[model samples]
Target: MKITFLTVGKTEDAYLKEGIEKYVKRLKHYTKLELVELNELKNTKALTPEQQKAKEAEMILKKITPLDHVVLMDEKGTEYSSTRFAAYINKREISSSATLIFIIGGPYGFDSSVYQRANDKISLSRMTFSHQMVRLFFVEQLYRAYTIMKGEPYHHE
Candidate 1:
């Protein structure tokens, strides 16, 4: 199965970019992984938070199809240990879907429509991090999950 990380906005920090790249490369060994970065919305000074989310939702929805299993990286979502996350991935792999799409929405968070469209939601931690930094953290966890699934030594208890 192919796992895709779809996020709104770019990773500007060079350090984060390098780290994300490293994990993405490592993930390639287990499955097809792709990171899709959408351009940030322009002229947001006038738009309200809900308006921003609605606009961002449109862009996010356009990228997803009914065939793709969509998972949102949400703050209120379920938190799992590293091994449990591997099991989550393994469960999806056994399903019929060809692609598993994970999304990280913009600063205002996801709209109602985006939340409605999601099949599941996952939380990285109780603490919040910048959206750019989440990219690095998520990818590294993804790499760890894959390694755990394969009984590789990259992950430890």
Candidate 2:
């Protein structure tokens, strides 16, 4: 199955960009991974947080299809160990032919519509990180999952 990493904004930090790229390149050997970064909403000074999320939701929904399995990277979602995450991916790949889309919403988080559309939700940690930093962390975890699946040394207990 193809995996799509979809985020609401760009990774502006130079260091974060490099880190995300490194894992993305490494991921090429294991699965078909696509990174899609939607442009951040413009002129947000007048918009409330809820309004921003609604507008962002419009853009996000347009990119997804009925056939794609959508998973939101959300704070209140299920938390898993590295091995368990690997197993989750493996299960999806075995059971579904749909494209798996993992979304990272904008600053204020996801809208109700976006949340309603999601098939599952996952949390990286209880502690919060900047949106840009989450990009790096998620990609690195993805790489680690693949390595663990292959019985490689990149991940250790």
Candidate 3:
């Protein structure tokens, strides 16, 4: 099974890129992984929150194939421990009919349409985090999950 991370903006920090790359490489040991970036919508000076989401949502929807199992990286979604997260990924890989996708939306969060299309939602943490930082955290957690699943020493009980 393949896993894809679809995000709405560019990652400006090289530090974030470095951190994400480290874990992303590790994630490949478990499954094929890809990070798809959509161009951020421009000229948001006059747009309302909903309007911004609408424009961003259109671009997001276009990138998503019908067969993809969309999961949002949401703050208010279900939270899991490292072991449970490993199980979740394993479950999807075993049972999913298509690629599993996790999306991180823009500053205003995901649009209503994006929410409608998602099959599940996962929260990396209860505390709110910057979207750029979330990329690093998400990839690290994925690596940690694999370590847990493999009974490796990287993860501690």
Candidate 4:
């Protein structure tokens, strides 16, 4: 199964982009992986938080397919150890579904509709992080998860 990370807006930082690209390359060796950027809302400053989430939710939902197992990367999501995460992906691969879509929502987070559309929610850490930084963190975690699945030394117990 393919893994797709759908994030709002673009990664503008050159350094962050470089790091994200590096992990993307590593993950490609283990799984079909890609990062998808949802267009940032226009006139975002004028929109209220709810309005922003609603607009962003619309774009996010439009990008998802019916077959995709939508997973949201949310702060309040269930936290997992590396091994556990590896097992989760292994289950999906063995289960033979379509792409596993993980979304990093907008700065204000998600709307009710986006939450309703999600099949699962995952947390990289209990601590909060910038939405842009989560891109690299998530990709690195994906690579690490695959390595653990392969019995590689990249992940430790």
Question: How many clashing pairs per prediction, in order?
Answer: 0, 0, 0, 0
Per-candidate TM vs. native?
A: 0.98, 0.98, 0.96, 0.97
Model 4 Cα shift for residue 144 (angstroms): 0.4
**Model 3 Cα lDDT, one tens digit per residue, 1-157:** 7888999998889999998988888888877899998888888989999999999999889988899999999998999999999999888877964888899999999999999999999999999999999999998988898888788899988
Compare candidates 2 and 4 on TM-score and give the better one. 2
Task: Tell me, by lDDT, which candidate is best.
Answer: 2
> Which 10-residue window in model 1 sums to the lowest lDDT?
21-30
Model 2 Cα lDDT, one tens digit per residue, 93-144: 9988589999999999999999999999999999999999999999999999
> Residue 75 lDDT in model 3?
90
The segments of candidate 1 whose C-alpha lies over 4 angstroms from its true place after superposition are none
lDDT by residue for model 4 (69-142), tens? 99999989999988899899999999887899999999999999999999999999999999989999888888
lDDT of 1: 0.94
lDDT of each: 0.94, 0.96, 0.90, 0.91
For model 1, how does the per-residue alpha-carbon lDDT over 1-157 read when each residue is reduced to its tens digit? 9888999999999999999999888888899998899999999999999999999999999999989999999999999999999999999999858799999999989999999999999999999999999999999999999999889999878
What is the model-wide C-alpha lDDT for candidate 2?
A: 0.96
Task: RMSD for all candidates, in order, please.
Answer: 0.6, 0.6, 1.0, 0.9
RMSD of model 4 against the true structure: 0.9
Q: Clashing pairs in model 2?
A: none
Q: What lDDT is obtained when candidate 4 is compared to the true structure?
A: 0.91
